[model samples]
Target: MGDKIVIDARGSSCPGPIVELAKAYRNSKVGDTLELWATDAGVRADVQAWAQKTKNQIDSITEQEGKIVVVIKILNR
Candidate 1:
């Protein structure tokens, strides 16, 4: 319920969003939730898979006006 870290990756291509998320994850504390905004359509699936692979928790994913918003909680490190 704290202030979530928001990474604006809008207008970025595939991997860009995930990269930003990764960087933010590294700097984030455990249990912190991150919001990633991406314009790429593939970022949703890519981020989900990355989160799963890394053992992170995906809180939710929302799409609005050609942008995808992914809420991910840092977990398991």
Candidate 2:
């Protein structure tokens, strides 16, 4: 929560948001939180699935101002 990476994916399509998140996460450290803001409805499920595949932890997901915000905690080595 304190140390995090925030990605804005508004107006992006299906895998676009997810792809951006993956790219951002690639350079992140263990235990760091990744906050993704997207307009794509698929982002919620996609991000969650991506986190599972990468062994990351999802803290919460919120919808505000027509945008979906996903908070993820990196748990990989």
Candidate 3:
């Protein structure tokens, strides 16, 4: 396991959340967990597709208050 990183993209729209995710992923290591917080509704699907494309694992996707919380387990594969 590595570290837990939180990328906040609250109030951001469309590709903003996904973009932040990719940038973090580029510097992340396998076994690391990334917790992303976003306010964009599109993030739910965007993150899912990104995880699938990158072969990473999504630990959880939940809604808190008005934000979407996504936990991604890095695979680096």
TM-score of each: 0.88, 0.89, 0.93
The digit string of per-residue lDDT tens for model 2 on 1-77 reads 43678899889885679889988887888878889989988888887788788888999999998999998988884
| Model 2 lDDT, residue 69, Cα | 91
Residue 1, model 2: lDDT of: 42
| Arranged by TM-score, best first | 3, 2, 1
In the order shown, the candidates' Cα RMSDs to the true structure are 1.6, 1.8, 1.2
| lDDT (tens digit, per residue) of candidate 1 on 1-77 | 54589999998775578889888988887778899999988887888799889898998999999989999888856
Query: Quick one: best TM-score, which candidate?
Result: 3
What TM-score does candidate 2 get on C-alpha atoms? 0.89
**Backbone atom clashes (below 3 Å) for every candidate:** 0, 0, 0
Clash count for candidate 1 is 0
- Identify the runs in model 2 with alpha carbons over 4 angstroms from their true place: none
* Residue-wise C-alpha lDDT for candidate 3, range 25-63, written one tens digit per residue: 999999899999999889989988999999999999999
The better-scoring model by TM-score among 2 and 3 is 3
With candidate 3 superimposed using the best TM-score fit, by how many Å does residue 75's alpha carbon deviate from the native? Answer: 1.2
Residue pairs with backbone overlap in model 2 = none
